[model samples]
Target: MEMSELTALLTREGLALLDETGSVESSADVARSVSRLRAAGHSPDLVSAVVGQARLRVKARPKFGEFADRMLFTRAGLEQATRLSVATMHAIRLRRAGITHVADLGCGIGGDSLAFAGAGLAVDAVDADEVTSAIAAYNLAPFPDASVRQGTAETSLPDEGAVWLDPARRTAGHSETTRTSAADWSPSLDWCFEVAQAHPAGIKLGPGLDRDLIPDDVEAQWVSADGSVVELVLWSGELARAGIRRSALVMQAGETHEITAAADADDEPVRPLGAYLHEPDGAVIRARLIGEVARMLEAGMVDEQIAYLTGDAALTSPFVQSFRVRETMPAHVKTINQALRAHGIGRLEIKKRGMDIDPAAFRKKLSLKGSAAATLILTRTTSGRVAILADRV
Candidate 1:
């Protein structure tokens, strides 16, 4: 979003028109609104900004819920904003730690700041981007205790208070931007680490961050929401839990389950394929807590290097998606197709690990033409690569 468009949209007529425009879910709706507004003598900049924001509000609903209606957003800002549910958890953690005021450095679109204020904590949010800081202030307008400013993370640091650091991981732009490497990240990971070490802080990082780069003393927690691993956070000082080096928090169906260990748990020994196969959640795998989950299910690894777990028990947990084995055969596509056809399997869900096959490409090679549906698990074992036909339990 350009500064001129933002200037136009912050006025009375522009905001009124945005509310009157209602929901714009399609390009056709945008076109109609643009034409209608243009015909009615509205400026092109105003029309563009209002219609563009309407479309963004529709897209932002999944992350921000009803709050997206009154809030403002830039294209890149909306994409990088944290989900409200996850941000609420962070706020709750700070509140529980007896922190009353927080300085949110590198606060993009003020997603976390909104949660902090909603949780009854005072917020001082700062973003280097001018438009993003403006939108953040508008979004946080309802909370008298929250404030937003335009400044770099370094210059905006407060003398005292807990800190929430979210270094910008993308290039400088409000509309379209590419990811910046760890070295190029604003406020740099090294500087963020120094801040965390000096004060009680929570540093949010990408889930796929290299494990070796993590500090030894901070508590590392990987979080997954509704089956997708979202973020990894490093906690320091009072925020860090004692004796817990790694943890996985899984949120699904409105319920949260967490597993914590002093360190990465040891993997279970590889064993023969059992009656049931369990696929661990991404959070569990990222946190390297699969052994803890395996112990809970009385399961063992399917391969020494594979993440798939096998067990004779038909047990299931929130940590894994379990399947009951029906048959096992060679991994060859022709033989697997023949077995699938013989079993009258029509619809198939292909899952693969420890193999190079692309599920989409391999699915095209299958001769599926029956009434039954099953899951085809393609993985490698101690013996060899095999295809196990199973049904979700």
Candidate 2:
């Protein structure tokens, strides 16, 4: 966003106008809102920024909830910001570790800072972008303990005993550029790790971070919020666990579930298909904790590399979604469609692993007409690609 646009957005007039405009659900709605605002004599830049932010607020509802309506956001910042629920976990961890003050380096729009301050920790939140920093300052206005600074991470590092760093994983501004690999990070992953060693620190990273590059001594925690694996965090100093080096944390609704291990867990033995199947949660798979989930279910993997698990007896756990095998169908698309028809199944939920077919396109080809709703698991076994018709258990 331009400096003038941000300045305009902060005006009493702009705030009143934005509040009145609210969220527009579609392009036509947005156009109408924009036209009304423009015809009412608002500046072009002000209207554009307000409209863009309104759309972003709508997109941010799932992550920010009611706060999205009040909070300002850049597209990339909204996408990269930690959900408030997940940020609460980070705050609790820091508090438990006896951290009273934290330096939130590379803080984007003060998402994590809000949680940290809400948990009674003092936060010095820093962002490199001026516009984002300004928005963050406004968003964090409610918490006096939180201070947002428009500066680089290095310069804004406060003299706090604890720290949290979320390095920029994208290019400048609200661009959609993905900063692949550790070196692309704004503060660099190596620098973040270095700081973590000296203080009670947590560094947020991509869930797809290379396991090989992870330091052996730190606690690497992969978190999935509402079924989506959002981030992997590396903890060090007092925040790190003594024996545990890896963890899978799952957050859904308001509940949090976690499983920790000493290292990347070993895979369970592969076994043939059984009466029941278990699909491990994304966090479990990302943390390589599928073996741990398998043990909990008294099951073995269907394939060594695949995360799918099978056992004769039904088992219930939050770590894995359980399903009862209804029938085995041929892997071919035509045969699978015929099998679905024979079973009187419609409204199918297609789940695929180790397969190349597009579920939506394939579903369209099937022309499903039955009244039944069932899950179809398209995956590969040692015998090759197979389809398993199943019911949620």
Candidate 3:
């Protein structure tokens, strides 16, 4: 069927067809509909609604398949591909700073743009892809001053109070290639830096990006959500008044750990690893300030070479999590099987740190049965297969 006929069908049928037909085929149908609608000179709002409904219907099932179609049919649809929890925290931080006018460069599917607009800030949202731009326009339709434009951030935006840029880290094919140069992404740092010079700006980068790659003038922030490193936030203008670096841990319920970036300050002395080994939070690990974390916990490194930090006193630092050291097992497949059998460890929680062990094969090898749950951590500290029962702190 042609794109227009499919779009007309969607406009008449709503999204129930998507759920009935399954996302794979539904997405193709949706794409065809979008093309038809565009050809028929449909209003952007109607196009946006049809596309948004299609996306909302298919997003939960087989995400990538539907996502590709959405990106193809709707201008700003790929923005929904990656939803950064840390970005929400950054927007909150900016809102608290009393910044009113916000421009979101590369505003994917309007996640951050909608967030800022919801927070009562005027938003100028831009994206390079036509489909994404349309999706963004629809996504931000409720906001009064939210404007979605189809253009690169360098060209679309005018001077504004604050700017948010999420550089495209994943390439065209969605491969995990390291971005060594700025030109690789749509809005290059050369453009972002110029925007930063004009007004307060926030740039989002990969969590694993090298610390040295961060510009000295921008406040580079490593953010983690629920102990996982999600993204890096670089701030310019008054946001960087404290320093050029920072770290944050954002919990699911909007709780946050905000820390300044001062690497040269005197670090608290390290103590010996005690009975408990605390795993540092993702933000702290990504920020590479484990020494400071040890200071906060009054913990000493068990093995200076290892990432594990041990401490006698149980202190709270958003950096590392506290885990009770339960039992130590020998690093052999048979030995592990024997231990699991001995302890009646029917259900196993396999966690790996510095070691390389296939979780699936290990679970299958044990062939566990019964109603018992114990957390097994496979890490290469001094030894391997360190099994410990962990409870969240």
Count: clashes, candidate 3 = 18
lDDT of 3 by residue, 237-298 (tens): 86664743655554644576665555522333444435677776777666667777777777
Task: Indicate the TM-score of model 3.
Answer: 0.75
Q: Which ten residues in a row have the lowest lDDT in candidate 2?
A: 173-182
- Residues 201-316 of candidate 1: C-alpha lDDT, one tens digit per residue: 99999999999999999999999999999999999998898999999999998899899999999999888999999999999999999999999999999998999999999799
Model 2 bad stretches (over 4 Å): 365-367
How much is 114 displaced in model 3, in angstroms? 0.4
Which candidate number has the best TM-score? Answer: 1
Task: Quote the lDDT for 150 in model 1.
Answer: 94
lDDT of each: 0.93, 0.87, 0.63
Q: Of the pair 2 and 3, which is ahead by TM-score?
A: 2
Q: List the candidates' TM-scores in order.
A: 0.98, 0.96, 0.75
TM-score of 1: 0.98
- Models ranked on lDDT: 1, 2, 3
Q: Which stretches of candidate 1 lie over 4 Å from their true place?
A: none
For TM-score, candidate 1 versus 3, the one ahead is 1
Could you tell me the C-alpha RMSD of candidate 1 in Å? Answer: 1.0
